[model samples]
Target chain A: MRNLLAAILFACAAWPAQAQLSIEITGAGGQRIAIAVAPLAGEGALLDGANASISAIVRADLERSGLFRGLEVPRLVPQLTEASSVNYAEWRSRLADTLVLGSVAARPDGRFEVRFRLYDVVRQVALGGVAYTLTREQVRATAHRIADYVYEKLTGEKGVFSTRIAYVVKRGERFELQVADADGANEQAMLVSAEPIISPAWSPDGRRLAYVSFQNKKPIVYVQDIEVPKQQIVANFKGSNSAPAWSPDGRRLALVLTRDGNSQIYLINPDGSNLQRLTRSSGIDTEPFFSPDGQWLFFTSDRGGSPQIYRMPAAGGDAQRVTFEGSYNVSPRVSPDGKNLAFIMRDGSRFQAALLDLNTRQVQVLTDSDLDESPSFAPNGRQILLATIIAGRGVLTSVSADGRVKQRLTVSAADVREPAWGPLNK
Target chain B: MRALWIVLIASALAACATTQTPDTQPPAGVEDRAPGATRPAPGTQSVPSTPVTGVDLSAGRPASDAGNPLRDPASILSQRSVYYDFDKYDIGDEFKPVIEAHAKYLREHGVVKMLIQGNTDERGSREYNIALGQRRAEGVKRMLLLLGAREEQVEAVSLGEEKPKETGHDEEAWARNRRSDMLYPGEY
Candidate 1:
């Protein structure tokens, strides 16, 4: 025992830092997915002494998917010993779909190991056993990776918990652009300014963003390199300047400008050159979006009165009107499939994100909740991220295209609006 | 483009100066000039700028008698709006006869009001289309006034893409929506 102590001390003195990465995999297949994260129990237990508990972090990761309802118990550590052996039948009766067991231990050198095991309750099988070892400083990152693995195993879906979501939060006259973990954890403001920002679109590579800014006292679209947090105005057109929709290739953007005495459509490169006009109309033409295939561009106009949707060639051609059933229609976003389209339908003053099935010409209302706008599709096209009002506060929301999961992201209380989900990891 | 803007402004200002008198103006420079004759044709006198009276702006006619407020109100059943190819705003030959008959009504009816609601097929932004429809309606309004309709009796507004006479996602619906609707002041 004395030798073990000295060896640990000597190792600590000779090494940079003791480290490990712990991962918790959730169980799948009919058995409720299990996760085992317990609060640090012993004295001087490594993590900020249990503030952001490992168990709570893991639980939030599982719960936020609108999947994996968690196990509600007084404590998870009670089941650590065999003395509390697997009370299988009792657990089954308790409706525990899965069980997570884990413990955190610290070394004398300050190195720590968060070991966890996932068990399938119905099958009486262990799904995975792993340990995340890390120096005292890196516990949070370890917890996130564990969540990612468990999410991947159970849902066959890539875990976005380890990813980040950027949003524009409007506060009176000022607006804050914030970045937070996909689960709404660790939110921090990137830019705060007293200006209007509309049409925040993520580039295909995800390192840059393009948005319309009123910083010039006029509407000008800017391409912001997120890594450097640098903002450069790419378009400053005469008359109205708004609605910057990025091409799927991420090389160009479609926007509206009234430089010719009428609001017309123009495509500009991200570097602020090669400006090309796509529509020459005597009416108001705005809100241009390129099809995912990059063949056609869709937009909204009032040439026929009120507001309706129209399509034109991205390279410029005859403009064709699409929406006729409604008195007012605007802000069309084409789905990635080059099939269905999602747009904002205005019935009187109420605006909702409505979906159009190209095959059947059927319209589906994807959101019935309060004043929602700017619905954007996830990379998978199965879900949409948008901004909606919650408890009198503007918050980010996600609804599947089928309208199944209506989840409100738990970001800061600063009126978060205009959510644009980035593309999957390249 | 800057020169174009100047030309447009000058023409608009010029239009403001040439207000015809509401008299027995035979369309002022009322020319049965053969088609394809450009304005100011080589020493040809432009209409002497006469005032027009007793003309229907919607039906484009003079009053049947003195002080007649109502236009002849000819049945416009066969008088249909001519559709243009895509972006062309000029009326085709098929529509000349319609405009001629409509112009005759205005020359006879002393006082009449007409609203030409311009339109476009749904394919672009609602705001942009509204502007396009305005141009189309304004273009039609200009043609009617040039043919002798009173300026005060004609008003043009663009409906954009809101109303369509046909229902389909094809050429037929598009062709129908791309023309102006002649609306009587009190009629839907």
Candidate 2:
């Protein structure tokens, strides 16, 4: 099949996902889990766009992680497999409590096994499964690793459904950067540019990605490689190499430079050498962000004269500010259990997507948008993902870290910008 | 770095002595400004102690009849953009004679080489509009190096809010995408 679509474009860095991203989801995440998800049996004899049916992409990745409610598979429940047996009293009398069947076949050395399982059904017991083989361009990464093993075997957390996000879209004056599949489907572009691709980040072993790049006309910082086509540049110095981040031991990066003239916060390394200058503040320290146990960095500063959210000590010195009810906070983002931070506040001229809490400093707000901006969390710190401006274009939303559920995603005419969210593909 | 370029030339000479009456404010948008209206206005307009030479103050042109005064649009060095006010980055005394006619044509063409850029207006956070468009291209490269140009002939970067010119979302396309743009050097 054209050498399997050129080996899925030499193992992922571009393939069928041409604009993709359609999400939508909307609120609802407190008590869902009804489950059901069937249709796997040989996946309608496989091969027609081989992408969508590993139990309909694990029931839309467990109903877009608004915590599962799928349910609707009752044709007297038959094609069950993995040695089918107990109907669990007709899937707990159709209210389902949990079911998830699966099976794809096609293996005579051509690869595509699949499998799935996961039951429980009011305790008819099974809650286990596993299979995969893969090909057919990894059937949506084996249905997001079987919806991250049925969302960590039914919500004990840890399930960013095979993580991967990174955004930026533009379209007209071009842009691009992409990288999808955290339910926005398989998108892939990894750097297209005419100029402008803002702060993308994600490098804690989810492979690579860093970002910034106003082509070479200004904001530099690069770092590619999320499965090949390589990249590099890691900060081109002299005024505006923008907010890059990464440091959770993927060995340094933090960014935002102006080469020593204001937009401060430095750090470097990912091959751009040990630059180090971490915030000197004559004000405007520019979104640094790290704190996932890499000690602390979390940035964005108008040095207290407006743009807030601070933090410091990841080898830097005495800073500590962290958003005080918004005079216009900025993009901070910490959370992957660094206990919440997320940012972008501004509230009256309306910039939205707030969240703070890092141990009771409280905050919350989450999105009533009029222009939010790259918030990004979800490695399992439960949702977040940002980038707003709805009616006038640019989308990609997500929410839930108690801001209920939300979702969005868009991309029919392109605009989406800097999202990030990778790292749990492990 | 030279005390952040002398605190960005004392806040671009205090926002060029309080915006040189750009119609007494109240219009530029982006959080309405007005609080103590940017101080420094005791009499206004004054950073001009010389460097006017080839004269083109708003295009009265005479830089020896502009053979290349930045491709002469009647030459105020063809007024290569300066605008601002709206999360302000200063240099307003009405663009200071087109940045002193391109800082006297880059101090009489000492191997010219400009390139300012800076831009904003797509509202909030693209890395804080890239540090507010590198403080509006380092406040027009510190007013073209305090009007005589050459801190190695200017470089200043930022295209934050990512190159808009006018992709409209109101406030007259964000007042022409908050400004700075200079360019020169085979017009990059």
Candidate 3:
């Protein structure tokens, strides 16, 4: 029976020499569908130490999408974290929409091989799989890519599992700009500073980070290379220099400057050469982000007697008010898709996360936490990484793109703030 | 520009409903909606729009439709969610009555521009949350449209977990944090 089953599975793996397999996920009606991923299994190779960790990360990403339910029961039929034997009836009883089973094995030559398949339980058939060769470092990413593919197939939207997040972790009074995997793993301090670090913005290509640091005790804006670990002053104006935002093409930086006395909006080249002031407001003007199309610059201003969101052309034009329903609105981060603007709106006594549509300009409050600030968008613009005060300490938090799945992120013992979530870094 | 100024004033009044909390307050959806009943019937009374005349705020329009302006807006915040679990954008069954009442008022009124700020607790990444918040706001907007809220009158936004009303470090706070708020002209 075992030999016959093995032959059947082997035939299935090579069934069609060039099978054009594709997987698609629909039926999201705002629901987190349950899924079960069996551990990986393959021939002539075996997973060494820590392969289990990689599978766990992939599972966490899917379950956290808040769009898929993952089975994590111990007594559950032995599921492969990669390719596994058939246990269809067991999972079907548990209401699983999809089953992900794959295998990873180590070759004697110190290389790795991976094979995987995604099955739609509702359809009761295979959708997609991969039989490929790779290195150890590439295995986790390949697994993540597979997870992304399966998630997108099921949710009808792109998956952001392969993205990254950049935030400042205060280590013993020193502020460090750190970049890590989207799950806060693989953390590496990108920049270190003695003073406060306010804002961290990402280039469109995820190659560089622009942020405002008080390294010299005075607020200074800097754009640092994410790859080479080099830094340059982007805005070190005479007065206040804070809230650095990168333009879409990564050529310019928009920030809050008080050089003219009262805080106003200013634009500068990434190399810190061309400094052009945008808003001439007598009140406060700060926290500017460019629209995805590079046509408009959205920022916070108090010219209307209270801080609210206003927009102006990137090429210097009269400003148009975008958020008129909130008295205190700041920290405007435009979505990558250019459909909405997320910012801090203080309505009456509520200082919370709120969003505004570009076309309709409607404002909806997204949070109820007190003193929520410094919001950054994910690469897909389907989620946001923000700094919110949790347990009297500033910690990183993430919210789904659709205002579901509020997750409080726990990173270091020190405070974390001003998160700049980059697009998928290749 | 006069018509624009009036509209701006009205919008400003709507915007002014926020901005009066102590900085120490837990940042969440604590927006105090004007009491549902206190708002005078539309068209019966002229709109007391507060234009930016550089005048003292004491002369501003009354900041309440919910009776007492002295009452905290946080006290009136919706204790229940408008969305289903694992769903970022949609009015759940629990909040239907609340949304229905609000929608009923919008149906009676003409094109009144309001911002539906979509929000989520700290869950996913910021960018995705903003989009989710936008989706959540759009979900509410779609519901209102279905219930007679004009499409032109509703705008959507996402503020992914930048604020929260319940500041605890547990599941309950997260629940309160994932929400979308309704914005109006006068009440902050």
Candidate 4:
């Protein structure tokens, strides 16, 4: 699996202009739907290459989702780029449930006109068709958008292809906070420092990142605008300031501050005003995360003699313990639907990612790694991205919510940690 | 900009140290037989007594006569680190004497200040480890204060798993990493 991922990364770097992430699914939750993506026809050479690149992206996206399987294209079938030209019988005979056909044309204004149609091969009918005008820079994004449409239409759930992921990477003495596509493509480092950087949390709107940096020999929380490169310290108290979690509303941050003599949870505005203490426990209180509805805050505390997850009102009140099975549970993150809680649980001496069904109160460990931490649910809540140690080095791993499918995202010689899946772009 | 201010404050502190006679409170159980045992001159501040027992200071040693106990291997203050159990921050009874020695040293030397940096093994979540490490440091600080160390003499901070005493992943390495190291200013 590692070798295959390395080959894909090498291929991507070999062709930077048309580079796309190649995902290899390590596991599947259940049966996958068979789909066929026909090679698109184009009016010019540029359009033809664009068509093939876009189709590859869409196919990769759908296949990586583990919900669809791409059917092998036969040599006899001619390339079809429109619903009118597609032979539904040919796709149906191949056991494909769905067929995607698209055409690319060069517009006079230098933009590309891309049209695509999704067909239900079983019913022999076109489900939908859409047209998009995009420039060269927007082709990749537009392809992802098209994939999102197809995925949502087929699975009846919102697609997270358009979402971004933020993570921290440490190489030698340099530390960087980076944002990239959910597939680990198009990585861009937003902040770099000689000191360690950890806990990169995204704002709800995906416009900024709040993270902890030790640039000045002490942990300080800083919120940096993702687009503008401007940064301001949101929490730099007298003592350690770390673990910045954004509220669902994006107006306030729930962070861990030791300014009051011990580690405790606090709330501060984005502009660093109106600081309010949330937990007054003598035992360490940290890793405060907000629920989807912005009503309750889930945090980790050691007040019960061991660290466990607890939930309390957002306005600070009595907190109720949530985990009992494990003596060590921390880094609680709620699913998008608020029906599940993902955290790191200690199994024997190894730490693994575990998910708790909020309704049934049943917990299931999702990872097998010996050291897993900082589990963040995807925007769609189908996968949880976490940092785990493999062969003594930190790497990012994404596991299916059901603990079946898993993917390891390695960054060569760098140690990557603290993955924060951003919200959907739209 | 912040570095400049820090330097300014440090120099200001250095200038504020007036060469007055040292405090007259002799070490515990020791008689005032030394030539410097004379009473405090007018307007001079007297040093607080070392309330801790078991120290024989009848040799007429000055309050600061220990000559930086932190560097003396035989001094309890030399044992800078206090270790704890796995995921546990509360200081064990075995480490109490170590804290007491440092507390006594702090009380005797009013000008001495130390930073208690807490650390943890690289097992749990990093941020959570940071908080746990802070509690460990604070646990030592609280013990020192309870044993008569002034509040300003100690500052507690946590390094989480960033600074590991041993890089190994086994219990031996973890045991050493899960500790609070007392560092005099500028030592780090």
Candidate 5:
């Protein structure tokens, strides 16, 4: 099996297309921040015919976060810019807690410069403003950055709007690995094949993606850079090779290989050297995940007669079962803070995404859907992106950690699944 | 574009030539009397003699051998799928004869290789299902090894829940999807 023919890899040429996913929110937030995003004065001529306006993108990003409510910002005689003065009394009457003002101007070098400022309506003070000069290809990213700025200033937490997401889209016999914005916009295809592609994972630096592709007639773990054309088959051993997870430092990877009697966790370098088996289970042991602190390894195993999540030292050691309430719980994903574990727990016959509080050992089922799998936490650990079958079609959904706010992402023509939220852009 | 067509056509012709050339002798079938032309048993089990849908055996045997036991709809070797219950990998007693027949065939022919692909229904975690599917295939592989088949001649792998024969979410489709399909050489 190791000496089989190399897979016929196909790189997609069409990318940066329209947003493949349309998001629908179904819940409200507690203590919502009412923010008003006014239209940029000079953006009409520059960003005409674009998919969305700058203000609209920023407002949508903040509203979908489940922590902010977008208030209507009426048109003014003179549109607001970074240098515009805010009428505190008027905004206060409109029930706006905060205001966002911006303007887009054409730079001398043929690029566009976006300047945005945030205002604290309650305090009647002006927050700081920043400017970003970017090419035409970066209009949406600039808007997300401005939203991130406001989110960080108000919520006092890192924003995930500017981060990217990776998912798989299946249309008939074609399978495409796509990268898009966190809001499911700016879709770009990286790899396309006739076989199935699943289990997409992002590197720590957000520069490379490691996923399992079955184009070679069997599952093989392959790592490919986001912008590079070439790819490397990191694990194509004799038996199956799958479930690739990168370490925090990006030096090593924890993957499952079946070369030894059955499925077992193995650690290997990115270049496919220094292979080490970390589990000695007679039963199946797979789906290895690393903690944020890089101290423990959480994986799913059937060693206890049923599939359950287990944790052990990052280096091979004794294992301890983490879930006991439900007979079936798997796909353990540790939060960014290492305080919670997100996995799929079976409720009767329905499978749902659930979160476990590591301190109290309390498990909370996040969704009440049927056949929900692949629970992936946002980089900030606020929301989980999972795949569920809705109306007989595979759709991706984002559910808050508290199970209060929910958003469903669907494509009109294709089936999307296996979502992996990339890390925040540094 | 013309060069690409030439390459496609050349590969197509090469594929035809490879299928026509049956270098290795035909594997031991249910009937051990003939090499290429073998007769099927009259009545093996309660399974219908009709060929199973989606079980394509055209590539497994040479075109000239029309009476191949593996391709005959009435032969026990033609039944390739072993179904299982929910979350279970153990072989049922009803399917033991089918497995025994294949194991006998493998034991007789040393040059023949078999590939067992385990699959599952779409539920729960996909990676865990992959592990479950692997266990299913490994169970069949162990059974074959115990029945006198060489370990080196059998390769067991899991397709997980990726390739489902039936797409419904009901129990009928789930039962059909949770199966291990046995493929002979040149069929995979």
Candidate 6:
């Protein structure tokens, strides 16, 4: 019996070697579908070889989802780019349940056309095919869109590849608010200042960011257009004006302002008018976040003498405490499904990312880092992005919603923090 | 006595004008001498100029000031920072005397203005820390106001976790960073 147990352990260790990308999915709670993406065929130069770049990005997106395992397929005879030319027997032997093949061509009008086909190997049928006509600049976005399409078709749920992440990067005395792709690529600084920048909250439409900037030598909330680079101070109250969280409909923002004696949650229009107070706690009340339905607003408050997560009506009412397991829980970010709350919970002097199931009232710590904060959930509710300290430098990290598939994103020679994953691009 | 006051005012204005222009040299015997330095007999007793009344005008005063109580290490006003526990903005009993002393000073000198900067340790959400730090600064501001400091005399702002007194990540560093610092205008 001991030898049998040893053999079982050996098999567990050896099973991961069978896959090309050994994606360790810990808490997915389902069988991972095996998918293989063949290299795309192209004729001429397509933005530094678009065929390879596009397929790699698609494979990476699927693998990072923690729901799919990319299988290794050896170069087969007559590399197939079309669905009708695929040999089901060959891919079935390679053990890939789903296969993706594509080809790219540069058009005469400085545009590129990328066509892809998805095949079900075991069923010997074509799942689908799509052709995207995009400019050179839109190639990466088109790749993410294709990945989203494939993911939705396979998982029956929308993918988050088309989403963007906004974060604050501090290098020396300069601070930059940067927006990057979901996979931490194509970073573009939206705002740069000598003073500190914090709390980058993406608008519901993914076109604007509301963040706290110290450019005026005081913490003030500014809603900046991500594309046009224009900004207006949404909360420049006398005292501290910070912690901007947008409503789901993108019309309003719930923020924490200390204009009145102490810090309290207040709702304001995106145009910086029609101010309405939301919470009336005498203690420190801040970090206001709206539920996906826009009916409830979850926030962090210390009114009970200790910081904890609380929720109240979006219009305003009494706040009911939600978290009780830990003495310290703050920065509650509700998931897109409105069923889970991602927050930072103090654990023996170390703050870590945690998720609370709204239905079961069970809290699960999602990270083991010594200092983790600003837990923002992906639009699809499958991942949580947070800021953590690694080797004394602040870096951005993401963990799957179920506490699986962790990834660290670091900017060289800079400290990155306060990462807010934006809504899915429409 | 009236002539002495007029001479003091004239000398103060001359000192201000001299300091404002970079190329202007100090008048004769006042050349680069420290404040309160005694000069040799030249028929005129060089009265040192004080920019702000009742405030120390000297630079790099010793931490253990034995002459001036305002700069003395033992003076309550010298203790300019009030520290707090992790994520708690409540004023501790130990720091009440220190704050009361500053409040008394501010009230006695009605023209004195101070900026209260609240800071938090490097932990938790950055924006939330801003609120936490602001509460700490406001806590001190409330106490100062209750003790008779004018509301306009004190401007409270939160640096959040951006500025740290100590850069380490341990409890000691965090304890030192979670503090509210009292600053006179132009001090920062």
The lDDT of each candidate is: 0.62, 0.75, 0.63, 0.79, 0.83, 0.78
Worst 10 residues of 6 chain B by lDDT: B17-26
lDDT of 3 by residue, A102-192 (tens): 7677767777777778888877888877766777666567667777888778777777777777887754445667777675556766765
Name the regions of candidate 6 deviating beyond 4 angstroms: A1-31, A49-52, A72-78, B1-75
The reply for model 3, stretches above 4 Å from the true place, is A1-30, A42-51, A73-90, A107-109, B1-188
Off by over 4 Å in 4: A1-24, A43-52, A74-78, B1-69, B72-76
What lDDT tens digits, residue by residue, belong to model 5 across residues B48-114? Answer: 4345443444556456546677666567787776767667788877778888999999999988999
lDDT of 3 at A357: 79
For residue A158, model 6's alpha carbon misses the true position, in angstroms, by: 1.2
DockQ of 5: 0.31
Ranking by lDDT: 5, 4, 6, 2, 3, 1
TM-score of chain B of each: 0.57, 0.32, 0.57, 0.64, 0.70, 0.65
Scored by DockQ, the top model is 5
Interface RMSD of each: 23.8, 19.2, 22.9, 14.3, 5.9, 20.9
Tens digits of per-residue lDDT, candidate 1, A1-426, equal 446444543443333221111112222223345443334343136547545766677777776555577766565444462223465676678777666666677766668877766666788776775777887666656666667667766677766666656677665445556655666655555555545455677887787878766555445678887777688878876434667788888889888775665667888888889988888877768778888888899988778856688898888888887877777677787777777888877654355778888677788887776456667776656567776655756666677677665676643435667677776655
Q: Which ten contiguous residues of candidate 6 chain A have the minimum total lDDT?
A: A14-23
Model 6 lDDT on a 0 to 1 scale: 0.78
Question: Candidate 5: where is the Cα deviation over 4 Å?
Answer: A1-19, B1-65
Candidates, DockQ: 0.05, 0.18, 0.01, 0.20, 0.31, 0.22
Tens digit of per-residue lDDT, candidate 2, span B120-184: 88877888887988888888889779877889989888887877756766555666667777877
Question: lDDT tens string, model 4, A281-376?
Answer: 878899999999999999998889889999999988999999999789999999999999999999778899999998899999887789899999
The alpha-carbon deviation from the true structure for residue B162 of candidate 4, after best TM-score superposition, in angstroms, is 2.8
Model 5 lDDT at residue B139: 92
Residue pairs of candidate 4 with colliding backbone atoms: none
Candidate with better lDDT, 1 vs 6? 6
Each model's number of backbone clashes?
77, 1, 99, 0, 0, 0
Model 4, clash count? Answer: 0
Candidate order (DockQ) = 5, 6, 4, 2, 1, 3
lDDT string for model 6 (A122-149, tens) is 7888889899998767767888998998
Candidate 5 residue lDDT tens string, A338-361: 999999988777888999999999
Residue B93, candidate 5: Cα error in Å is 1.4
